[model samples]
Target chain A: MECMTENGGYAAGCRENRRDRATMQSVIPDAIEVDDIAKQFGEVRALDGVSFGVARGTVLGLLGPNGAGKTTAVRILTTTMRPDRGRASVLGLDVDHDAQRVRESIGLAGQYAAVDESLTGSENLWMMGRLTHLSQSASRSRSKELLVRFGLDDAGDRQVKTYSGGMRRRLDLAAALVHRPSVLFLDEPTTGLDPRSRRGLWDVIGELVADGTTLLLTTQYLEEADRLADRIVVIDQGQVIAEGTSAQLKARIGTTIIEAVFADPASAEGARTLLAPLGELTDADDGRALSLQVNTGPRSIMDAVGALERAAIEPLTLAVREPTLDDVFLRLTGQRVE
Target chain B: MVPARARVRRLTLGWTVRDSLTVTKRNLLTLTRNPELVVFATIQPVLFVLMFRYVFGGAIQVPGEDYVNFLMPGIWAQAVVFGAVSTAVGLAEDLQSGLIERFRSLPMAPSAVLVGRTNADLVRDVFVIALMCVVGFLVGFRNQTDALAFLAALLLMLAFGYSMAWVFAVFGLRAPNAETAQAAAFPVMAVLVFASSAFVPTETMPGWLQVFADHQPVTAVVDAVRALVLGGPTASYVVTAVAWIVGIVVVFGTLAVVRYRRVT
Candidate 1:
């Protein structure tokens, strides 16, 4: 919880206007804290000095591309794998020294669904509950509750192999939640899922948060992080490149993009030169479109329009928009988040 | 309800055993649901019993005893050993499917996954062995010993089968996938079952091969069961069988747990 007092103060203050929000902030504490964890797999350094923390009841998105060590970090924090150096804790218990204690307070739903394919959905959850030391009656009742909650009531008695991808993912999540763990780790929970299923999982995650479970969610989807993360830490090539709220990260780009699609490539090139002084200009879509990063926000559109008028270059379309998380990622990591 | 903080400190040996049994129940449930697997598993040993009893029984002679009596113990030894390979295949599937990762994340004992899998497979070996015994009876195999001796023989077979399950449990965890597990298990199983007294008499083999075939674990188990079932000097063979079982369980069970800790 020491990390929470330091890292969560700013986010908590922003919500302090509401009485309930302030109470929640004061009541709960840091649920996960990872400090300079470094792990190496032979010649490849999977994680190097990666550090972050999640406040209780908040979602901290570990945003990175494939092999960026998001899953590695999640594994270390969940006590399923140990880091070669440094330390992590879940619910204030050391992951390495007090691994069993840490495990008792946390649940993990990995990238792939981990439910037994041969077992029915309810049976899978019940088995998980029993493993967590619930009594038989309690396990059964809890399994029933979870199956109903995950919208799998009708499919509860069917083998997991008979389930659709989405249903299986839901069952996996339900299995993790069997003991109502105080903290949860979801490593790309919706990776291969369709949009509808992804949204369904997001809703389930939202509900978990609402019930005050701290979550560490790792995903390559910028939009998923933007929608769900209270705070985000971007990792690339085994290092933390940036850490902030989604809006804060977006603000780091510090420019509005003014994009103008001209009728012809020559006009687009001409417009790029004309608007070069306003901001950085680059041709997109094989010179069919021009995008300029201007610091003047909407005013950049007016400037572009005025310049085009004087040049007698009537652009087909013009728009100005703020930089997105994608721009922030591209600026920081020199690659798209995906 | 216990507070979360309090529960974190409450891990006990009893809880570990309970959790392992829970995992065992889950595995056994799968067998019940997939009846085809059981049917296929039983079919292989029955085929072995029939092929050996009728096809090779007349040609291979054990002096002063019916061929069926001598062959049935060997079949039981081979059947349980083959049944143990399923433990490897099942564990490999669990590892490849990410179920092991799920279990690793739980607060349960780290040994539970291995213990549960081996325990379930032993139960399966017991059932398969009983079926094979009925098949043995139909093929003219008879037990001349008392009820207690027969019971001891059954227990010894199960104990040996459980140890073999651990041996293959190590192989299963090391295999990249279920198919590879099955492939890896077959050659070792073939050598142990075929080279030992489980098939042809060890005396009929060549000098060097006989030395190994007579001393190997499978031969010891087969000889012990044969003596118990056919009324012979049983004490020495029973001690040797127990010793083999204990040795296999210690060596391979430790190896399996070590591999489980290191696997992803």
Candidate 2:
């Protein structure tokens, strides 16, 4: 916040700071770099001057709602689609001129499970291995290794059409890894999975990150981004609206939210009126839940508690919670992440 | 030593062939695993053979050969053309399922998917045509030519189907889904199959219709196959048929590859 005054203004100072960092990081360029890329389909602009970079061996979560150009960005980076404008690169190779080399260095698991349903899991992986130029023996061994790693060894012989949604996704991810690519692009990898399956996938991703795999994950779930991302870039309507660490982005709205749920709307209204001076209050559904966003740290909760106590209103629940990525998304885009 | 650029080009060409064969193997494996598909592919041609031979055999006439002899080659040509429709549907299914995107993102050859799919369909055509020939034999249709000539007829039919596969490959990439691919391909198939001399003699048709029926590629291929099989002067029909096949392979092969590039 002080940089606003020190560097003259908000937008200019932020841009200057980013330029400085980018210059510094240019010593070792990002593993994945997208520079001012744009794409259009008929009349709809799918991606409009979007740019971002992912450092090596770190996770950069691309957060957005549907139609936010996340998949288009992935497609461009994966060399499946070319941008109408601008350039992208993977592992220091230009994606357009050296697309084959770029493909050799990156793996992409698309929004849908792209595994061949008619082929067994092992066969699918083996085919990917062969296509990536692995020898027959190497491909066979890698297929077995990936099936075991993804917990699909027992089901490896069965056709992919027989596998569950989660199993199919795992196989698809494994197929992408057949060449042991350095950079991975997962577009909504857990979109349709149940909670348990999503968690299982997150664990696999965690292990990959631990093994120093650079990942660019696009996700609609703010929780998924918060849980996995070291840095986050939020895009909406084909543009980057905000980007930072989860805590940094959350700080844009407020540091903490003091929430209180009353038994009735009358009690909530009374509490909101009494606590009006504490900070900014957003009344929740049906007016039974009230949340106060306060930049003041722990003391803000004490202030809210003292105010409610002074008013003689008994609330149903009261808790001080850190602001979530959802709050940042709502503040930036004026809509929920959904 | 070879220049680096030439060496890289050679390696790329080598990988293109290898990748195409790998994909062809995958498609053939899928076909084998789905027994119902094999059953239906064979059954439809057999049904066509039986229906035309028994149901419509009595009314049709050829100039010199038995009606069954003329009918068999036409049926084989029709079977091969229809077999190519499955190429369209299969490719469209891959597109809808995101399998094509997956393949495109890999480091493999760009032309492999289309080449592999058409080649696999050609193999399936061979199987279905062989069964149709067996059905043709049981129903009193016999080839008047030697074994080598019969083999040449078979090869010509496969070449015709191969060209149609390239044509449908373009339709598949243009369509949004498998059902749409089938819908778009069938009407064209009907036009080619019926407007030609596949089911009846072009000479028996009215004068204007005969002009089209005589010149269309399907009729040329069918007439070529009939000449090779039923013992006649094969030179002109074979020349025209080969010209059509080469022209279609050049034109539609380019269109299909272009459409594939624009898919994602």
Candidate 3:
């Protein structure tokens, strides 16, 4: 919220940055387009002119830290909340005017398990089916099938309150898919799940995407997004910071990394000055070791070692590796991707 | 073949009914599972009716064989009013459980939810009225108005019960939590109990209280039910009671719908 108070002179200086590209047209695409979406909670702008799109049959993961605008975007797309400024559409239908149609085309598994605890696992799905306007016989049949597919057939008769968290989450997912929606929305589905349950859900999502479900998943875990999403759109403070495939984003910074590990202190200072002209040197731990970013392959590592050897500086360990998405995020945002 | 649109409409209605019955069944199950709640829900009306009938029946005379007969209609209306709280409390529980948000995500009709809920409450309220009627009869009260009149009295009480539902539904929706709804129900119910002719004749009250008891909707409802079921009063009270039913229904019903949309 303090960002709003520091804007009088800073806004003018920001306008002078002329390097910002005119990327506004990208917000007007057809499948899922949001333009100038802004929302204010008192002095806090939850979404500050947020804009983005996701094409049909493509999985776009909305990635951000906690309290980011990812959930707000999903809420707007799911027709739960409307933006204060811009508009949003899902599958060519406006979220506000065509909310029913939008809801019909999308299935959402929200952050919490939304199932009724008193109802049996099968009854929960049957009740959802009834809400979807399915025939009684058809609803029963479909509910039974989803139960079997989700490996919940054995516990179909038990009340949901008796089930474990993983079982409940699985049943929740099955309930979301009962309508056979074309697009599925999952907002931090794995936020509270253990590792094994999360992996099981990952498999379920992988299968869903493989069989042609256009999934828009919002998650705080970069690894989950990387494993499940074909493309990720990183959002922070209600704006899209970056959007691309995993490999495409990693390529933003150079691919190769010359990581030098030191056994003890007092040796990395000599290595830093020796390799400073060849590449940017980052001290691994103050003066313990030296790491560098490079555009070339293992040749940079060899040159650094030759330079350090000529300078009579001894290094304990050296390695050449490719940078991960975490490194790419740090390079762009100047903070760890927490 | 029938058109797809027709199928969807038919299915939506089917779903609404199914959900409503499911909710009613759940409430009934709560009573059966914890039989103590059954006694607790009926205890207040039973206590109030007894206080008015046997405790005060001989002192304040109506032109009926037993003063208990005159008290039955007033008791019925009050019991039905108490029963409307179930709807509000049930809705508040659903809100607390996040079940309403689950329903919101589905392709369900917007109005179907409240409609189903209000309808289910109607059934539960009527059932509670029947139990009160049985209790009244066991205590030596007889209905001189016959079976047809009894049915008419029940329907009027149910209609009045149906109208009072709006007041609580609003509280339930705006209530930040389920406990808020439960806490707010008591004083409101007490106000209606005090203002109505549930205990004493409106003519015998003090001047200002008489005017209030006369103009109050609950008094009109109680007087009408008394005339129909016990049949000592003139036909005018029945006319006034139906008017009260319609008037409260129109105003509070609209308010309930508006508040529902606002809170949701």
Candidate 4:
């Protein structure tokens, strides 16, 4: 990125980015580059000036509430849907002008399994191979290999309608890889799976990234993002609310939460006033309890606890720990989501 | 390692057609596995031939004497049109199911997947058309047109079958769901099949309806098939029918391709 900058700073990276964009190399170290892209559906604006980028091979967790444009952005980058405004290129190919090439370079598993119910597991995989422009011999061979790898070889000859949901999702992912795309887009890949199966898929995704495939995953499950993503991006109403490494985003919300259980309303009132200086204090779920979120250190925690006890509110419990991604999402989007 | 031109051309018609054919073969295998669908898809066309040829065969008369000969051409056209619809429904289902989106991610030609699907539909329609002919023969229907003329009729119906697919393709893309696509296409299918001279001679119909039906392109197509199969006076209609088929191809073909671009 630096070599292209003769004037130093922006000039080098700017020139390289332009060259990379023109040549279709996608070598900006960022696997995805999104500018002010937005989309509208009838009266609703699905995406509103959303922009973010993910470096190569690093899983960027996409999180938002149900109506958020998480899936919409994934669809745009995967070349399945074109944005009405703003330009998006995956692997340096403009989605509109070079969709065919972009498609070849990226693999997408949408929110649902798009497998043909009539086709057998083997036939579905082979069909994907054929659709990917593979020869008869090559498609057949690749289908066989993927079937074995995905643990579907035993059910390969059975119809897809007969396969379980987990098996179907696995087959869908396998089919996406028939062409061996360097970039893989998964839109809520683990939505309906049981815990075991979801974990199984998580392992598969990790292995894929380890193999150098850059993955852009849109998931609502906070744990899925926390487990897989190198960096997490929180989007709400089609705009980036916040983005950072998982730790950085969490740190933004502060550490240490103090929980105090009051004997009555009188004690709870006093606890709130006593804990004011430690940090932000708020009423807990129950009317008799109050909690304080503060920085992670003994001075803060001890002082906060001492004040609460002195206020005649004998604490039920008190603890200090770092904030989770949920707090980060709440702080940025004004709404907490799973 | 290959040059850019060579790589892009690697996905051209020659290779894409091979891919399409292989995809069609796989789909055919999948369909054959579902014996129920194969039976269900072919049954309606066969029943149409049997019911119309025997029950209404004698009641309806052409300019020439024999009802069987007259019914043969009409039944063939009807069979081809009806048989092609299964492919349209299949395409709609694929769209709803995410199969088309999955296909878009591949390096294959966009036309290739649809072509493969059409190929399977054509194969299925051809077989169904032939079966209806057999059923037609059982009920005393016969084609007196020479072998070349009969071949011409088959070619016309086949071309019409493939061309009719574009209208349904648009529906399949635009419809919110597969079930809606199936429901919407049938009414249009019924209008064309009924509006044309598929069931009765346009001359025998009520005067105003006759004029409208006669001038319509489907009527020209039916007239060509009738002339080709039963040796009627439809030479001019055959020329007009070919032109009509071409026009439908261009118009609806554009719509289907445009709709595909929108969806993708």
Candidate 5:
């Protein structure tokens, strides 16, 4: 949670960085850069000229729904797959030309948990350590260290097939860190975890960021991106539709949502027409609820209630909230992120 | 001090060996955790031995030898070749589970996973073949030749099995899942194993059937091993068997490596 909270300050710092962005780009350097990278699989264009960069020691959330080319971008950046056009580099090394060296400095946890189920948790990590060229003793020690750090000490000797889904994810992340990689790519790291497990993973990832590990995290969950990422690059259908900080993305919608729910469709419809002049009506599901975006904030809330009252419409419930990332996503893509 | 290029070359070579062995140990450890994997691999052929030796023994005739004597080499060859199917199944399972993707992303040698898998499965094949040999003895089969010749036969069967491991590696990479790998491998292997001279000599067959039975790789290996262990001319069959083994290893080994590199 230290890094999670610190991220707000970090993002503010990044905003200040905007004034000197050009000079800072020359000095600090980007840990990962994708320049118009494109990839096609048979009839499907998985990535269509996508471009972005992650500054050193910052988290970049590649936010998108399924099949949006986030994993494709990650695969190209991690040196596991090649793009059909353009280029990418990691830590100043070309991903395609210096793939071996790139691999030595980076770690990746793919969408699927990739640890061997037949091997013990300790054995999986130890084997990864050995493959990364650690000595036998070093491998054993690192395995033990990571097992404890990830709260897998008691299950270290058990086969991974016996582990729960959340435990397997922790072990997978542990395996990726065994080599102390400088840059890490996690594709949908908490895609299938429960809320509690996802939050726990977020904390661990937050700690990693606090230690200055540059991370490229792809996720479908907007709250995950909002909570952890210093910057977000929202992609849809293999294209970057929006890129900004969480607050900035939310600000793009430029309004607060006023939702009024009535007991019946006729009353809801009545309220909609009465409240039309107050703001632009957006989503009113099944005609029983009405949602509108008003730019004046709290004053608009008073206006909406007064308008409804004058029309003799009794809303079963009414609430006002700032636009969430979900609202931004829906506004940008014309479809919900889910 | 070494030149920069040579130093990097030495490091790459060192890591290749180290990484491959690490993966090999990982696969072997799975066997220790689940001994039934080996037991089931051995038990299937043992059942074949019993079924063939007792039920078919009284019906079939070998010109100058007991049916068990001729059958033992065939059974050993069958067991070793069939053992190779696990290579395909194991690899397909790894691919399906995304473990292969993890390995590809690591700073290891490109061929390390394949090398580790085939080598470990070869070691398993050796164990299963040796156990089949003991089963052969218990069921009244004996080697007519000296100990050196017997050792040569065992080694030959192992090499043939190792080659088949590469062939199955291709099937594994092409298959989408473990079940598909097993399904594709077993039927093709069943045809190759049962249609060859492993079960009966081609001399008793029709001309067209004998042509296939006498010329296939499985038949060449079985005939070579049978000759080395059961007292017959050894040079030609051994050479032919070795040639087929080398050819298969070259072609399918290359194919498997290429498929592995392109695997998504």
Candidate 6:
């Protein structure tokens, strides 16, 4: 779609421009780097020495439960908030010492869609473009180009207040892309969106990554991280407890799970005892259901059902499923991702 | 293709100014689109003018002048002060809505948001003042001075309003929400505008209260604007008014900017 520059330029041209500047100094392997960043609000430590790095032209999904400092870290890396005791750099420029340069090289779509409700979609984009120092014609053309790219061209002249939630989100994303920043930060971008809208945004993000843009996205949706992230960092409370690819995280949780739901609490206990030989049985807090970590794949489910049938245990439902990112989060943090 | 040189150029003062103006344009555009805001802002001043001219004008006598003439300047000064409240509410709204965060994340000059907000509200205050002037003229409020003097009076009132906008911008940033920002602005407005020579002569008040009324910034602004419009000694009052305006802008403007930087 030639969406890199909003003016029909390859994304590499912008990368080359940044490379020329980076080479003048020292080359930066990562598009963004955070080291021991900390922030506190009076008595509460919002971010406790969080550190991460995003390799150039890749997506780093920051997975965290609420209050886990994902937004705080994003704010620090975007040069909007200063860390209490550590450092961050974006595109090889120090966020604190060279905040202006860092701001020029990055775009941020905050947890909330931050477009002005009073202005038209085009006006909002035009304002962002101008603020980034694009010339008047450039700003106008870029706004139009972004509107079309984001599928907002039909509603570009409408006030933002009239936009649906998904439309506002797309406009907000378009606003961030107006200046063609090399590194983009989306803080829970798909949050509050329906599944269809979320899928649409995911496609747009995938395209941006394919075009060589570096993205640091924070999301509470484990499935989203698994689907779109090249690497995922899971944070709990105010610290990162686990970091790896989606597969690596899932692998840590084992291969398969045999989930059985019985008609009554008594049958669930009987099913659990009958399926004890299959694999490790995870403690099911719900009396009417039980889950066992099966070492074997689908065959283990058959074994479990056969054993239950032999024991004359009538299970309401039984299935075999792979360990999802949700199970990984629950295992690592002792808390559910959602 | 986008030019690399253009992308990497250092931000100039001209660019900052242009960016600020763009933000200002957005603010004004929003104001125009929201008819209720304009109507509400302008209606208050008109009501004040009508109420004072009809209800209080008959009982209050200002030596040799008509009450409408005496009340016009006061109404204008009061209207400008009240108009500044929108700055606080507007800024707080932007903050609560996350628009401020978006601007903060952008590469524009840090002062652009504050400058743009204050400048746009000043333009609104100008409109409100002109509307009040028309209302005043209809009610037999005549200007004894020349057109230049009247223009100076209007400019001084706008300058005072602009400074008040900065003062409220600080409150807006401190406020947790827009409603709180609006509430926080009221006490300051009342203490400054109502306690002054806006509606009544300072001489008629108690001696202890009169000291504050006569010396406060609003009194100076109102007296200066009144003298300029009604043919009285204006030199000292004009100096005091300008001093108050500049002083407020310096103290509150610096504080607002500092607060803005620390708000993350």
Please provide, for model 4 over A235-330, each residue's C-alpha lDDT reduced to its tens digit, 9 standing for 90 to 100.
888888888766667767767677767677777777777778779877778877877788876888878867765765675665555666777777
DockQ of predictions, in order shown: 0.68, 0.53, 0.33, 0.48, 0.51, 0.61
- Superior candidate under DockQ, 5 versus 6: 6
Runs in model 5 with CA error above 4 Å? A1-26, A259-275, A281-291, A296-320, B1-11
Clashing pairs in 6: none
Model 1 chain A poorest ten-residue lDDT run: A1-10
- At residue A90, give the lDDT of candidate 2: 84
lDDT of candidate 6?
Answer: 0.86
> Pairs clashing in candidate 1?
none
Q: Give the C-alpha lDDT of model 2.
A: 0.86
Which candidate's lDDT is highest?
Answer: 5
For model 3, residues B118-184, the per-residue Cα lDDT tens digits are 7766766767788898989988778887889888888888888888776677667777777888788
Docking class of 6: medium
Worst 10 residues of 5 chain B by lDDT: B1-10
What lDDT tens digits, residue by residue, belong to model 4 across residues B1-264?
A: 212223344566677777778668866876787777668766876777777766877688776558666666677777666656666677778888888877766677667666677777777767777777678778787678688888888888878877776657777778777688778888878777787788887777788888788887667787888878776686787889899889987887787767776784
Off by over 4 Å in 4: A1-28, A258-292, A302-320, B1-10, B232-234
Give TM per candidate.
0.92, 0.92, 0.81, 0.86, 0.91, 0.90
Query: What order do candidates take by DockQ, descending?
Result: 1, 6, 2, 5, 4, 3
| lDDT for each residue of candidate 6 in B1-264, tens digit (9 for 90 to 100) | 122224665668887788789989999999999979978988988998888888877887687788898898898888888889899999999999899998888889888999999989988988888898899999998999999999999999999999999999999999999999999999989898778889889988899999999989999999999989989799999999999999999999999999999886
Fnat across every predicted model, in order: 0.72, 0.80, 0.39, 0.73, 0.72, 0.75
